[model samples]
Target: MDFGFTDEQKILRQTFKKFCEKELTREYVAWMDENCDFIPDELYKKLADLGLFGMIIPEEYGGSGMTFTDYMIAMEELSTASVAAGICAGLAVSFGAKVIGGMGNEEQRRFHLPKMAAGETKYCLALTEPGGGTDIINAMKTTAVKKGDNYVLNGQKVFISGGNVADYMLVVALTDPKAAKRTKAMSVFVVDAKTPGITVNLIKKVCIHACGTTEIFFEDVVVPAENMLGVENNGWNKLVDVLNPERIGTAMLSLGIAKAAYQAAHEYSLERYAFGKPIGSFMVLQHYLADMLIEIENATNLIYKCCYLMENGLPYHMEAAMAKIVAGRASEIAAIKGMEILGGYGVCMEYDLQRHFRDYKQMVFSPISDEMAKNMIAQWTGLPKSY
Candidate 1:
């Protein structure tokens, strides 16, 4: 199989790169990080105008109807400029319009897709609870009981990215607690963020500050039965379908952050003189740069392989997990090496490397942790479960 980006994909990547260069300046990123708030409306609108908000959404729903690979390209470019911006835009498209397009009923799609595709509304996935992260199927505590034409929800979701600003959320809750299989007991619902008995509280974070991660409390919140996505008790399968793609996207974001850090370190090494000689001339510094490049290239290859599998409709869960782990580890290494190359300047707020360093640390643990990824790979190979 050909392992090259299509001409259209290449052009799209370049276009997005140019957009980031023009709009996502270091000063703007710094300001947003320091403010620790949602992305500005104007900037979000601009991204929508570029059709970034509809990369995976269908054209009929006012979206661009692009492939997941195309969406990954956009995510990488946007994240290279600022991880927070990349995440905000990525969440709107992937978890927002794409989910509705893929799983929602016709009416639900018609009502939500257009506004989400146009960036008039924002959406987030609310799956993780305070007690559950990777142990989602077993540890999920959220429950929704069917009432007269409605489902009453009472649960808590923590570490929900963009929860505070999102207009809608895809909530995962248990609908059949007594089902023999935990996976079959779970269901998914689309809930309005402003629904009564819902409370959202922003959680201050040390990295990706502009993304506005939050904890949401649902105290006897009522949702219409019509809002259920797919068949009841099928949310687990639907969630699994999305996880592979989301993991691939996470890999791309990690790759971007690593590449950014590597580029900075390489450029700084070439220009900065130490002991009357450029740091590039030092063997130790050269080795660090070499290791970073090798890791970045390896991560990129794995990500491309996973993307190709996705584009070809091949089973990609294993590849996606591998890609995420490789990319996240590479980013972690690049961040640390970048800081070492920068010396004291690396830790200063005035420099962007420190931000990359902090962000990569968080990225390594999110979406799925490195240990979890390893466990998945092991299980895929027919090995005994390790966690």
Candidate 2:
């Protein structure tokens, strides 16, 4: 297998890097943080112009049809610019259109993917509940009952990014109560945001502020039965399939935050004087920077491996889980080290390091926790697993 990016991919990466530097600079990022608002519509359109929103969807569905590696690189660059921007684009590019491309029927794909690719409809994955944190599999309490040609859904979802602003939501609910464990009992439905019984409340979050996270209550929300993705009761498998890539994207978020924090620390070390010399001249500072670089490279390599496996249709659940675990831990540690190097200024939100630190911490708890990833790795190794 080739270890280097293709020439086209390299160009794409450079283009994204330039876009971040020119448009998603620290000053713009600070403006969003201070205002606590969603990314501007104009910027989202700019990303669409760059084909960032549809990086993975097929050209037939209005996407540029790039490989997973391209998508991951773009995610890293976007995160490097703004962690919240990375999360937003990552979810839209990696998961939003994917739900339709992978599981939706031809009619669904034709109807939905084009709009999603065109940035007309932002999609949010609605699987997490207040009570169903990491226990997303067997612990999901949302229920969807059949009603003629539509499904009546009753449940509440929490911690859903894009929940408030999305035009549509992919909701996971139990459809068959008596089905066997780990089988065709769960179902996924595409619910329109304007559905009468659905209520979305904006959730105040500590980090990743530019992205919207909200709590949604579905009280007998009517979703067309035709909107059910895949088979009615086989959503469990579909959920896992969708999430495998999501984890890889989350890894990119971690890698980006780590890289951003390291850059902040490195620049500060060189500019700040201590004992009549730049702090970066100190041996201890050099060691810390060296360690951060090593961790970033190792974790980034693992992320690329997982993305490649996913793109090639290789067996990759364990690999993706491991990548996320490593990236999350490495990013958190790197952010902490950056903070240490920056001293009192690190925690101040005026600096990008603190924002990255908060955002990276949130990444550790999402998609799948480090604890959950470890448990998955243990199970894959044929060992008893506990989190």
Candidate 3:
């Protein structure tokens, strides 16, 4: 195994890190976190101009057509500065534009990809409904009935990220309720955000507030038949296709957050003194930093392995799940250790470590929980399915 970034990849990583350091300053991140609003148009446009939102898109569609590994490098750097900003940029390109790129008809791609790549349009995925959570595929309550040329959609989706300001949403709904299999009963459709009878209410959270999670209600919203992605009743498979990349992206984001927390704690240990001695001089504190470093290294390796598999068109579902579980827990552990090192400063909003702790805590339960990930591994290992 090469086990090293290419020269170009190294350059790209440094470039993005510099961009984050310059643009994603603490003041800007603090302002957005406090406001809890959608990412500002100016900031989105700046990211677009920097080509941050088009890494995975093909050049023909106004993107850079970069590999998944390149995208991961960018995600880690951006997320190190701010997880909320990283998610906004990464999702806009990956989960947001990827479905259309992979499943949409030629005309659909022509219509959506360029604008999405340019950040002129923002997209969100609506899959989880009230009480669905991780059981979304089976507990989905949304329904879409095909009419003459359009599908009338009804039902509600909760905890949808970017829903409030998204220009459009890729919505999954039950279209064949009587199908023998639950997976065969669902379909995916693109619905305009401004369509009639659609309501979006922002859900406030203790972390990553600027990402704009919301509850979206749909009542008789009409969507053109052409808006359907892939084959009817195959939305489940399409969902599976998109999830590997999303999970890997989530892992990279967690790794970034862990790195940030580790850096903060390391710097504080060197500078902060107790009993007329630097905290870094304590053997116990040294061990904590060492553990944090090891966790970050392990998570980074797993994430890069997933990225490599994805870029090379290899099967990565199991690996992605593993990466998510490892990275998520690693980030949580790093944050907790970092907090312990900082003591009172860790809980104070004045220090960024508190935000890292909060955000990493939330990540532990999202993008597939640790329990679900272990269950997947068990199934893949020829064990009985659990949950």
TM-score of each: 0.97, 0.97, 0.98
| Candidate 1, lDDT over the whole model | 0.88
Q: Alpha-carbon error at 277 in model 2, in Å? A: 0.6
- Superposing all C-alpha atoms, what RMSD in Å does each candidate have to the true structure? 1.3, 1.4, 1.0
Show model 1 residue runs off by greater than 4 Å: none
lDDT of 1 by residue, 131-201 (tens): 97989888899999999999999989999999989889999999998899998999989999999999999
Clashing pairs in 2: none
Query: For residues 173-227, could you state the per-residue lDDT of candidate 2 as single tens digits?
Result: 9999778774578998888989999999998877888988999999989899999
Please give the clash total of every predicted structure, in order: 0, 0, 0
lDDT of 3 by residue, 1-387 (tens): 789999999999999989889988988887888886677888889888888788788999889998888888888998888899887886687667787788788888889898988889999989888966788877888999999999999999998889988998999999998889988999988889999999999887888887988999999999999999989999888777866688888888899889989999999999999999999999999999999999899999999998888778888889999889888877888899999999899999888898899889668777678888888899999998887
Which 10-residue window in model 2 sums to the lowest lDDT? 90-99
Q: Give the TM-score of candidate 1.
A: 0.97
Q: Per TM-score, what order, best first?
A: 3, 1, 2
